[model samples]
Target: MQEKRDPLLNITTASSIEWGPCDPSVITNPALSCSFFEIPLDYHDPSIGYGRLALAKLNATQDRLGTVFLNPGGPGGSGLDTLNMLADILSSLSGGFYDIFSWDPRGVGSLTTPGEIFCFDSPDEYNVFWNGTVELTGIEMTGNFSDPNDVHALLAQAPIMQAKYDELARRCLRHSSGKFLRYVGTAATARDIVALADALDGPGSLVNYVGTSYGSLLGMWLINMFPERVGRVIIDGIVDPTLLATQETATAFHELADADKTYEGFLTGCALAGPQGCPIASAEGQTAADIDATIQALLKQAHDAARRNTSAPVTSEIIRDELLSVIESLGQAALFANTTWPMLVAGVQAEAGPESLTARRSTRSARRRTRRSSVSQQNQTRSYSNEAILCGDSIDLRRTRMSEVFGTVIAASRNTSEMFSVVWPAEFYACPFWPVRAVERYQGPFNKTLANKVMVVSNTFDPVTPLPEAEAVAALLGDNARLVRQDAFGHTSVSEPSQCLNAVMFAYFVNGTLPEDNSTVCEVDTDFEIFPGVNTEAILAAMVPRKIK
Candidate 1:
């Protein structure tokens, strides 16, 4: 018997598209045009409703090869925003020969569009959920015990975390509309991609795409579900679909372990760079090893103080939060470490006296001001949308008990990664009580070969999606995929400035070229150097490719 084809491939109606200049304040590009295209909220049931998915297009300055669809990840990331922000760099990378296009998926971005997912009615409510007076809110749900050896404290706090999650879940369900939540999964978003392809590229045309981080998950779903429509796909920062699809304790442990390894890499890298290369390195005449030992001692001091509820300025919570910030931007660690490491040191030194503590507080406040603005109101909606999609996409959390989840997290903290164990497992905190599930989720035959070879990129020491996960994804996709191993410390390899990596990617996107070998490893360009004390603006400017006028 023949398999049923996706009806979206047969869609004949042309999408009503309008192009207008983007808001200059938001996107300085005068040439960039933004628009909205209507797609069915539930692709399986057109009767449900139609919603507009926001899109932006930057036509190639020179001759265009074709259109390349881009997704920046986040599960809730705004592809439209990505294109707007990186138009010049992206166009340059594509050799000024491909039109770059991206969209904000349903339930993300503006509520003015149909099918916006809302967990909290207002930003104030969302802030309360994440950073309110509640003791068991936000990061508190996963108690900030800095030492991995603090197993007793972690275990004791597990029940409290579980209870808080339960309450949070109940609150989400009470606040959000059930109808909107049901259609926010990655599978549905994949279908939407197909619909957009059908409309823009003509009916039944294969999709040419690039996705990073969580966006890689979406790409995997698209190719597996609609293999015939796959074309020139690159899944960078690959997420392990097998692990993500299930409720496995081992998977959670492995992810945190990966994060811990990445953190270790940062410390090692900083030490090797020494005093001139790394600001966090040991003082004059001291070895890098000495610096590492000092950091460990300071961390211990802060941990003990927090445990004792002392008046010490540096608490476990502050340490954990700072560490997380560093981890998130590990790709730019050579530059980021200059500021973050100093801040960390300041926090540790604060225990010396009231004067030191006051200075540290002032420095922290100034740093906060210099940092990017808090998540905008639209981003709050995006955050909730991310939760809805993740909950809907993964195995039903309701099947597992909250205690089991908490226990697993505690066990991971104790056995695998004391420093980062809470990060991944904590994401599951509110999942057990998620109010809705996707009406039609994709249970994959993920092993199927695609119509075209897919390119998979992984960082050697990615804090989030690690090397093993990318390798697993490549193995799962069989001969239809090739893994590009980037020897760098970062979440996504493509976004990092690497000439060799970019050359490989460019060849594939422009000329359909694959690496000569099944597995290709690329090294960082030695010429690209990041030094301590370089202006942050200069660092960013150096990273971005020069745009062709």
Candidate 2:
């Protein structure tokens, strides 16, 4: 029986696609023994094809089946890169029986076409557009964005960029080798993934996958479309499709609040750690440290510099510093598996002292002055990724009545969080003007109730996806998902190299044993520690092989 065609399918040029082995070096390190495959740029549509897919084959024994295909959460992040970063973890869990593999998605990583979409040719361009402007109360606080007229002019440029993107999309289809481009959507990608069991492994072989953040959405789509192919799939920091169409603003605001909570956790932990080199302080319970005060001072210095048109100001240095601090602080708990709290405590204390704050303020002032002069003469187009991914996946920002209802919240956040929140006002206007409406909307009754051996993990404090977001995911996944709460602060719960957390994840994936319902907590240090300690090897031993020795 002929199946009904997907209404969203783009039927462009119907041509044959060519597939061949890729340059293994492109994906695998020269030191590793691995091979790769290159699928034509246009996987489904032959006529609209240069885009190539680079697939990496891991070290597995003969008679092996590929169970795992890892995709990092970004709608734009490279799957191949994610596998490489987590190669050690993958090897430890899947063992010799499962072939672990990854591929560069279309328009990402090695398969990226000759276009300016993903790769910014210049670091300066990225820094300027993404990090250049300082906004407050929906006003550009510094540089060329200071005027309301300037804001309108910049917003007007999105259409021009959209036109350019349209041309690029058309060109990509016109020039490709096969009908592949038509099938690159998440649903199609899932189908292609299922075909791998046949292309690379024996009959009836399935896929065991690990997808995080945005990748979780893809995982869900795959599971819904091909439930039979799923084997020990782990969807970490899950995203509910139900929330994508209706509650984008609520989601964003919730995440920001979570970020604040994470920051507070870090600060409290830092205070306890005491004053050594860390700026925030290492002492555990103390109100006098006033880290909030320090943040305010830093911001005020920056604002003053901007106003005076001085050569140096606090805003420039502090913005970058704050961004790095939060990212580093979060990474420690999520990625490095270290108790960065103590170190952060020390760092904050050291920096917040009377002498350091003055120096930092002066340095920031200098940076602000320089940035002000440079950005004034520049004319650049903003990249579309920020809007494309968010708006595409979101419900509608307009439904929230953000500005009117959240005015008090925004103002309070600005006062409490210092100037950082003020510097980047929400892009409320872009959602209203998004070029394309979401083809499909996500509704509630998210699949939290699936009766599967599911496990969910999250940091106590996460900046981007945040704890609340994770909590929502847990609630949505319901009985099927077990929540593993790491006693840490960050964006992703398991990004930190926590032996205990890793053990739970590995056990669940390799042995099909989910953590118990309710809270299963793993403690991680707040700072990096290099010493002969903690027998993590035992946990590693338990997880390294899929089959018993």
Indicate which candidate wins on TM-score: 1
lDDT of 2 by residue, 211-293 (tens): 77666766776665555556667766655555563554444344354555545444443333334423344243443236545
Candidate 1 per-residue lDDT over residues 1-549, each given as its tens digit: 112235554332454466787766445677688776766667677777766677788888777666778988877677766787788887877777778888877666662243445556664554455442212211222233444555554556556656666666666667645467777788878877777776667667878888888789888898998999898898888788776676534345655546766565556556555677776675555543565566666666666654554445664445554565565565466655576566556665666444654344323322221221112344333145556777777676546665576677667666766666654323445566676777767767788778899999987767667778888888898789989987666568753467888898878877889986555878766554434443222332323242211
**Local error of candidate 1 at residue 423 (angstroms):** 3.4
Model 1 residue 118 lDDT score = 57
- Model 2 accuracy (lDDT, Cα): 0.46
Computed on alpha carbons, the lDDT of every model, listed in order, comes to 0.64, 0.46
TM-score of each candidate structure, all chains considered together: 0.83, 0.65
List RMSD in Å for every model shown: 7.0, 10.2
Model 2 lDDT at residue 323:
48
Model 1: weakest 10-residue lDDT segment is 365-374
RMSD of 2: 10.2
Q: Candidate 1: give its CA RMSD in angstroms.
A: 7.0
Best by lDDT: 1
